[model samples]
Structure formats: structure tokens, C-alpha cells
Target: MEIEVVVPGGATIGEAPTWVAAEAALYWIDIKRPALYRLDPATGAQRSWPMPSDIGAFALTADPPGAVVALRTGLFRLDFASDKLDRLAPPPFDPKLFRFNEGACDINGRFWIGVMFDPLTEASPPLKSSMHSFTLAGGLRPEPDAAELHNGMAWSADNEIFYLSHSQRQAIFAYEFDPAAGRLGAPRLFASVPKDDGLPDGAAIDDLGGYWCALHGGGRLRRYKPSGAVDCDIALPVSQPTMCAFGGADLEDLYVTSASDQLMPEQRRREPLAGALLKLRPGVSGLARSYLVR
Candidate 1:
């Protein structure tokens, strides 16, 4: 399916584009610039929230219910109706060790927020990160292992497995998941992508159980089946395709978000379209909307 660049917002580092079905809108975050954006595909109306720090990623929560955001420090639930934010978990016990990264919600509607070594410090260099998960009732739980640059969070259609990408290694890993217990098993390689384009950053699952991944450096979006096979590739004009999701009324439209934070001066000039939101009508459709746990 062909993808098109729609919202030319020119985000510095756009990641985690998610569809809020009930609102008929797409939500995403610009990490480096630290902003939250809400976009209406139908009307092209965009609203934004200025954040104090770079927001790693976010998901909808249940319980007292709101949007859960992964900040560089810790996890917080945002009361959208009241425009308030409350910390759910303190930053990693070892503040110097890790910071929040990319993540998404599980099929059960619980928010999963991962972490990586802090990139701002000399010891916490890029790509040296780890992944984690958070549940409203259970709190935060660390994954067995982590990555240098963790990203591209997702879950399978059946919710039996979870998928995440390591930008530093240029690999996507699939973990056997237990939805009822909210546990992850040993991870198996889902895909091995080339580093020249970029590592996988964010992803989404389709009804077919295949994963659509954003190649952060690859300047493209790729589809991989549960068997770890490449299904198709949708190349983009930009270099840093950070994340993507299936949106629109029918869930057949593919929306991609990109970034320009790491581009050199000359490269940035050449790829001015980097960091814009793009869209396309892929023939394949997505699954039913997964509401944010309230």
C-alpha cells in the first residue's frame, strides 16, 4: 500500500503515533522537542501540550483512567479532562541508570512503558537502554533485558505476544506473552533490519497478526509476520521514520510519524520533510479500536 505525507508539522522527533478511535483522532509525541500532539484526520485540526521534558511514549490507562505518559524521569497519568498529570511510579530507583523510552498498551488495555539508559549522560549513551512495563494496578515491572535504544512497542492481534525494537541493534524482538498474568517470556528475533536506514522505533499490529514497524534510520515502514518474514516495504522520502499506526474511519489508512533530531545540517536541508506526519491508504485493514483503560 502506498503511504502519503499528510501532516507537515515538521516535528523534530515524532514517535508513537496512536489512534484514539472514540475521538476519531491520532495522538503522537515529539520526543526531543517534548510536545504532545492530537490530530483529527477528518478535519486536520491539531492540538498540542507543552511538556517539561522529553516524553518517551504513552498509552491509555484504566482504573481512575487517563493517558499514561512515560517521561524521562518516570510514569504519569494525565487527566485529559482536567489537564492534570500525576506520577504513577518514581523514576528508576537508579536515576543515573535508566530513563523512560518507547512503549504501548497491551491488548488488555494496560499501559506498558519501557526504559533505557539515560542518553543525556556520558555513561547512558544512545542505544544503551532497556525495556520495562507498567500496569495501573500492579505498578512497574522491569524486563529481563534491555537495549541501548529501545523503541517500536506493540502487541499481537491475539494479545499472546509483545513486540519491541532495539534501534541500536537494528532488531525487533517478539516475546511470548501471558495476557492474564501480564508476563513476558523469552524473546525471539522477529526481524533483522539494516542500520543504514535506521533501527526500528515504533510499530503497530494489524488484524492479520503482522507487525508494521517504523525504520528510524531506514526512512521506511516495513511489515513482518509472526514467523519473522518481511511482508512488504513502504519507502518514505524522509530519513527518520520514527513510528506509525493504522488510522482513519476504516482503519485502512497508514499514518507515519518521523524525526529530524539526528540529521546533520546538510542532510536536514536535503530532507526537509523529515519529522512530518504522512499517510496512505493501504488495502489491508486494521483491527477494532482498543480503548484506553479508564
Candidate 2:
């Protein structure tokens, strides 16, 4: 339950931490810098690839043999070796008005991403954001929800439930998911985190059906029981813990990403570890991630 800095990275806003077990590496994105970063835990080696535009999130594909990145303009398959980016599909909304925020793969290998208003510093207009579903074959499809600042993206152990967080709303929702049909039922109010605890951000589901979510700007990570009761809350050094994923060979190590963006000069001086990659052992194994099959 003790979290420590594993990588002293200075990402403007590090989000979308994904554990690529096949490569034995953790991948995350810096939203403002518009870059993709990789860190090898064993060797303490790190590298980065500059993105063509602001990349909010991405998915690792097995079929296409590269990263499926969600940029401000559209989704593309990025080839680092050749510096080639092939457009997979355009965003459902105009890039100037909205951008992808956080995403993850579903049980059936479909990529689910949430859109948010551009320039998150100001209040956003209603109906400007949405959740989109994509597949390598079908391209992009929009869901029924309109979210302002969508962040957390996670699925249940049985693949029967879907969890997503609305940061502005300070709430997380649960949907009856049909993996076979790739459909989501009406969302049910799952949990509304306390305001002082910080807004709900990235999340991960455990084998015990517990939901572990990072509290952005709260300097804490919390685990919610199945009944929506608080089970655990661990303090973190960074105030803006963006996202987290279970990594390591056994999938027990929880790797978290933080941000240094939007901090006051005095605040930055007080928290020097604001944008570092964090590692911790939660003593519970994570549910296997749904990989992109197409």
C-alpha cells in the first residue's frame, strides 16, 4: 500500500497508463506535450515518441502490430520505426471543439474511448462530449452518453459490467454490458465520490470485483467495494494522479501516472514529484486486460 516514485518523469499531464505485458513495458501519454512514453521497470530505461498532435489515449493492438493512438484529429495506427501514421478513423466530434480523454479495450476487443471538451480549464457546453466505441473493422461509433470530463475506464471481472468516471460530475457509473453483442445498457449510479477526496479519474478492476480509482488533485487512490462503500484509501505524493494500470509479470504491481500541468509556481516547488511514475503493490491481482484482437 506504500507508493513510491519509479520514474522521475516530468510529463505535463501523464495519463492513459497501459500495461503492455507482451513487451513487458508500461506505456503512458503526456496530453499537453503530445508524446508517447515507454518505461522498462527492470532496466530503468525510458524512451519517448513525439506525437503528430495531442494524443489523449491509445491501445496496443496485436493484429496491426503497433499502437492505435487517439489523436486530436482522429485515430491512427502509429509505426515508430518508420514514423508512419495511418488514419484508422476520424473523431465523432470536431477536434477543435472536443478531444479524446481516456480509453480502454472491452471484453470483446472493442476500444471504448470517452470524449471531453477542449481546453478543460473552462466550463464546457452541454452535449459537446460523448463516448465512442471503435474496432479495427468497424472504425468508430458513438455511445448515448454525454460526458464533460470523462476519465476512468474499466470493466468488470465477468465482463458483464462496464465502469466509467465523469470527473466533472464526480461520479462513476456502472452499465450492464453484453460482451457478445457489444452493447451497453442504461447506466446506473454506482458511486459519487466525496468532493474533498478529489474527482474520480483513471481506474482498474480487481479479481474480487473491487474498483480501484485514482483521485486526481486529491493525492490519494481509493478502492471501492462492490456495495459502493469505501474499502481502502492510500495517499500518494503527487496531487494529480491521472491514471493507473496493473503491470509486472504477475499483474500485481500497480503502476500510476501523474501530472505537473496547471500547477502554480509555488505548488510546483512544494511537490517536486508531481509528474513521476509511481509503483505500488496492492496485494491483489488485477483482472486481465481485454486486448485488441483486430
Specify the highest-TM-score model's number: 2
lDDT string for model 2 (4-41, tens) is 68888588888888887878988888988998878888
**Backbone collision count in every prediction?**
16, 0
TM-score on alpha carbons, each prediction: 0.90, 0.95
lDDT of 1 by residue, 1-294 (tens): 455667884788888788877788898888879877888877779888777777888886545545788887677788766768888887753555566777776667666666666646576235444466666767877767666667777777778877877767788888899988778888998888876766777888788887888877777788887688899888888888878788888898888888888689899889978889999876678765454642
RMSD of each predicted structure: 2.3, 1.8
lDDT of 1: 0.76
**Model 2, residue 29: C-alpha shift (Å):** 1.1
lDDT of 1 at 103: 73
